[model samples]
Target: MLFTTCIEHLRTQPIWFLLISSLGFFTILKKSATFLNWVFITFIRDPKDLKRYGSWAMVTGSTDGIGKAFAYQLAKKGLNLILVSRNSSKLKSVSKEFQAEFPDTQIKTIAFDFSSDILEGVKEIEEGIKGLEIGILINNVGVSYPSAAYFHEVDEQVWMDIVRVNLEGTTWVSRAVLPGMLQRKRGAIVNIGSGAAIVVPSHPLYTTYAATKSYIDQLSRCLHVEYKHCGIDVQCQVPLYVATKMASDIASIKRSSLFVPSPDDYAEAAIRHIGYEARCTPYWSHWVQWCFAGLLPEAILDSWRLSIGINRRQGKLLIP
Candidate 1:
């Protein structure tokens, strides 16, 4: 009765009623769209038909972990691959493996260490990929601290390597590939990011790694807006954890699960989301974790992160 009376009263002021109803409808519609977007991302499964972007895909750190996984996934999509990594032999071996499996697809390898002069290495990449219709670039190469430590206790060399490999590598490699993509006027660039990049808790011990990934996140966002008009897509695929050598020091993620996925599993899901979302935690389980984490207060999350980092540091030190 009271609600009915209120509606009747508001109707007398027709403009006010119209404005309130419009605002309510808009808010409901906005929420519905957001819910539908998550549903679409979670349930839909499809292989990336990457030929629309270009004929070939390039992956840095292609010999192992997520980079190798991306290479395999792209090859499965019927695109030729340019494999870039530090080990010449490993690159050759991976190239041979892909050639055997995807017999119809062409494979090329470039040995470029991210820890070296990045510009020089990019020139090598440029030379290696010359005259090729390279359409996709996966900036997957990065380095992390050997173990978690206070910022002052970290070796200076370790800090330099992390910044050089994570920040400089992603920036330079993207630069090397963008010209070809622009000329083609269609391409996709996926830069691997970390959950530590302000997506979850504020990482306390591994400050450098988190900060570098933060750089990647911003770079991906800026590049997306800048190049979307040119038929290119740039995205940062932020993942939490995977059963890979890079994450071996973390005890909780030592084994792969639905949430903490294997590299191959994560890559399969990550590739599907590349051209669609600007910043995404590609695995469905990770999306659930992201949402759950969002509900906790920041103070609690900060303390939890600090404890985990300390435990991980002790565990790493105990290993002889």
Candidate 2:
């Protein structure tokens, strides 16, 4: 119906006009669903610019949960993939599912745990992806430890493990992939963060996780400013309490959309936004955070954040 009306509208334009502006637009709308799609297919789809970067996405910690969700959605977009996680079996299972469900998209997997030894893992990944052109980088790796203790009482190793997985792994993987993106002058890097960054002073259990997420949040915003001229889009997809094995039993998580989204569901929302049109997303909520960041005094914001961090635990860690 739209095409018909467009054609009718085109016919009404004077022939002299058709030879100019109207014809060019009519030709554009008729040829492709989108202006960019036409251009992409025509010039970038092949050995030429026609197929820019060849639909390869690398996702870290993708053996289960959110990372796996991203792999599935990218497959639908006709992307071949490199899936990474610690568990070889889980990676094989997800990769097999992708192959069976969507035969066209290729799938590759790497199973290296991102504990303190992540740098070695990154080097291995660099070697593995040497010749491939990865157009998308979804940094969905993270870790959350439950049961809070006083900051000093917490085990140092546990705290360090959180940092190694949440911050270091993400940093290393991005570093491994970024040189190519910089050289190509194009790519999308999405780091998963959390709502706690703005609202919580210090979540007893999630202290380190929140800090690393804050790092990712700021890193993405800075990268956007740093790389905007070079045609790179960097975004952080930050949210709260997902309903994975990690957060399933948490009482504060009330609903799906607000608190606990299934990984596939969240990935679907995130995959739709491959461009960094916004510094932060969950568009409305982050807009409010952006405004509050400017408006609220840091002390007042910290108090409010502390309340959110408490969840239902009354401004402290839940005790058994």
Candidate 3:
């Protein structure tokens, strides 16, 4: 009855009726399209055959967290693995674990610290992959603040380490691996990004960390455009929060939930998104968070994010 009355009143004002109807129709259409695209990409679209890019997939920071998960996923797909991390002992253990599970998959480990001597580390990677076909590169190594604090309250060395490991490290590694991909005219480079940079307006306490990830998102866009014709797919995968050591220590997310996925669970979704969009939050739950964040005003988001950081600094549990 209300709907019929509304239609009748609208019909009496033809101009108003047409204008409102057009707006409503477009809004619904746009939302429907977005929903369908999300469904297709999240569930229906098939993952690329990773072997087509090359035989070996190189992952940075691969001894633990998302990088380790990616290494395992790639190996399961029959791709040779090149695991890079700063700890040689952890690398050896991870390599042995992978070998035990995937005996047929070849594994190589590189112990190079991204926070120190990046040029030497890049050289090590270049030399290590010499004459080896590297089809995919997962630039997943990054650093963040131990906990939320004001930018000035943080030590200079801490922010410097974050920049070195997050920005410079990604840049140098991609430069080292790009030549090989260019020569082959086919490759995929997936940079693991964060929601702090892409989804929210401001991440106040973790300013340096957010800025570095913003760089990753921009670099991925430019690189994708630059090398798409050459058969190279560059993507920045933005994830909200994975139940990793970083989240445990820094974000204080002790348990995985609908919003915070386990590293392995996140990686399984992430692999399905490679070689598609230049930027994506591969996990469906993260995508939903991104959408909701988009609906709020920037000022609201800014205040909310700042409050969360402040609460954390005050020794309050924000997640639970």
Candidate 4:
């Protein structure tokens, strides 16, 4: 009876019914297309072989976290590595580990801290990669607050260090490596970005960190346009809550879950996303989070993020 009444109502308001039906149909179609595209990119698309961009890959902040994971993954693909990190001892240890595991793959270490002199670090990288064809550059060196705090509550030097390491570091390193890639006429540059910038509306307490990552997103998009015709791919891979030392120490995410993947698992997905989009959230679960986050109102997101930031400031466990 309800169905027949609804059909009669629709017939009575034919134009209104048709317009509503059309709108509903198109919305479903658009959503379906989006879902299919995500599926294809996440699962079906074959990743480009890393060697085709160049025989060597350089990863910044490679002593630990996602950068280290990328180093191992690239080495597994038989590419020589130029690992850049701040700690000489840790760099040497990681270098030796890589060499032992992948005896056939060459490994080099450059111990230049991005938090220090930017130009000197760039010079070090330039000198290290002098003769090698560095086909891939991973601008993954970044720093975040130890814990969330209001903008004024954070120490001056702390924020300065974050800007220096996140923004200046990425800019100088990309500048140092671009000449070689431009000369070769083929390369890939993947900048690791955070979901704090792209996924939510406003990250209140971690303002500087999110702002820097937003800058990375813009930089990657512009570079992608500028270099696509030159056969270079520039991408910003925005990932959410990977279970690394950084996440554990900073965000209090102690355990890896469906949404929070281990560094290796995140990097495995991240590697497959290069040379495709200008920006992407590569992990499937992260993508799902991104999708749902997109559906909420900006005001609601802002409020939610602020509450989380407050919790972090209070030393509450984010994922216990």
Candidate 5:
């Protein structure tokens, strides 16, 4: 009887120990996912934090380029879309394209040109939205520098137009949508900014345009800090010469530093980066240049910028 008992104990010992070890391993693994999630994850840092949307998303300048890319990507992720554009026909075309691709999602178009003297139409857009949930708001539609010329030489109206569309439109849309987001305690704002916002080069066409982007950076930063505790995320998407109609002039589109990202790639990186990052420097080289700009003396920076090749031909911006 004693020998039989010893054999039984020996056989059960190994199996019992193995079972206990397996349970312990699984318990630790589960806790790790929970622990990491609880500690450092900020502003939808993981897939589990993703809040699904029921109602709407508004992207300004949605008919083309970065805005268009954001629309398609958001639609693919199952969000209902609102496409805004100055052209009804272009808006319709964009709406139709999305409708065909995402039969399951809702696509609406607002045909108001926010860039031209037609900003009087912004009020209509302000009243047009009704959302059960405004999950993602992308302030993307904006104008570019007209020509690489001096600041004073560029038409004053054009500069005003840039400020109106790029900065004011963003302000109005963000101000209009905040009530919904704050009430629900969930939403994301993606503001499209430029490298010029951080490193203002001396390009004639870029002067006023850079100022507009700087305003966007400041506004976005304030919103990010204000809403972070409330679970709302504000992000700025800055791309260095992303390939789109925006960069159609290939002759002058040299990458001063790194590889130029396609609009799609730029959108993907920007969309994935939610929350506070000083600015979304898409390329390492762009980031390096930006740091250099930050370190430069203001007078020196301005001097070098005006001296750069973009203005060497016709602009007497040298302020001699």
Candidate 6:
């Protein structure tokens, strides 16, 4: 009789009853196994399992920036390298440097430009890695707008280059490498993405660049779903800002900070997360930023992004 009376009383106060129930549900979720596993991976997980993907790791745009950093880190783990870049001289220089530092690890170079004929370059990549057991493919070759600009203001050539380098390069390179992964049934593909595509509520100024990057994110998700059962892992690594030549225009991004990491620092964290998260911010600080930013409504975030875009165009001081 008492239990029935208590239930009847709670039902009478619907709002309070619902609030209490919702709190209890959330509390349970906080302590669940799924939550604990997520916490473990987001905080403490390491890259000890990367070798299961294969023996050779190929990195595009590897002569400099994030691509170079990934190449060096993979070599540190004793993985052979296929370093692809636009500059053959730089490729030889970087390959020689890797050979000198990591004498035990084998290194190959493929000079290809993402802004040019991506199909020809992909054919070269396919021919170069023939008969080699490729375990990991880093689809890191990408180009951004020279500066933030309205869609109409961007030159036709610039638009083509952005799409060609970022979207076409990622697609064809992954296509060329995926068959090898399928044959082995054990490989990993890490496609470099930007927060402009995956994290931000809106990217106002760099329209085409963001669109290309968004394509990469979607490609990663679809491929991950399709290949996961076959022992292959596909991940899109979304990063906000790093101290790289491409991002050097903004004074704020010129120096490496905790939030804007150096290429090597970001890649070190990113490589550890290859097979773990389908879309990851990689840097812990960026994750914190994402959490805080998520609290705002999309309209507010989009408005703020618009303001930043305006400020950048007007040559005014703005926080990235």
On lDDT, the candidate that comes out on top is: 3
Candidate 2, lDDT over the whole model: 0.71
> What's the TM-score of every candidate structure?
0.89, 0.73, 0.96, 0.96, 0.73, 0.90
> Which segments of model 3 are wrong by more than 4 Å?
1-12
Against the correct fold, how does model 6 do in TM-score? 0.90
Error of 1 at 319 (Å): 15
Better of 2 and 3 by TM-score: 3
Better of 4 and 6 by lDDT: 4
Instruction: Residues 170-255, candidate 2: write the lDDT tens digits.
Output: 88888888888888988778888777674444444457767888898888888878876776778887655555655543333434
Candidate with the larger lDDT of 1 and 3: 3
Better of 2 and 6 by lDDT: 6
TM-score quality measure for candidate 4:
0.96
Give Cα distance to truth, residue 1, candidate 5, Å.
61
lDDT tens string, model 3, 90-201? 9999999999999999999999999899898889999999999999999999999988889899999899999999999999999999999999999999999999999998
The residue ranges of model 6 lying beyond 4 angstroms of the native Cα positions read 1-15, 18-38, 250-252, 317-320
Name the runs in model 5 displaced over 4 angstroms.
1-55, 116-119, 200-205, 249-251, 254-258, 276-278, 282-304, 309-320
Q: Give all candidates' CA lDDT scores.
A: 0.88, 0.71, 0.94, 0.93, 0.71, 0.87
Find the 10 residues in a row with the least total lDDT in model 6: 246-255
For model 4, residues 122-194, the per-residue Cα lDDT tens digits are: 8888999999999999999999998899999999989999999999999889989999999999999999988
Model 1 TM-score on a 0 to 1 scale? 0.89
- How many clashes show up per model? 0, 8, 0, 0, 2, 0
lDDT of 2 at 258: 40
Better of 1 and 3 by TM-score: 3
Off by over 4 Å in 1: 1-33, 45-48, 316-320
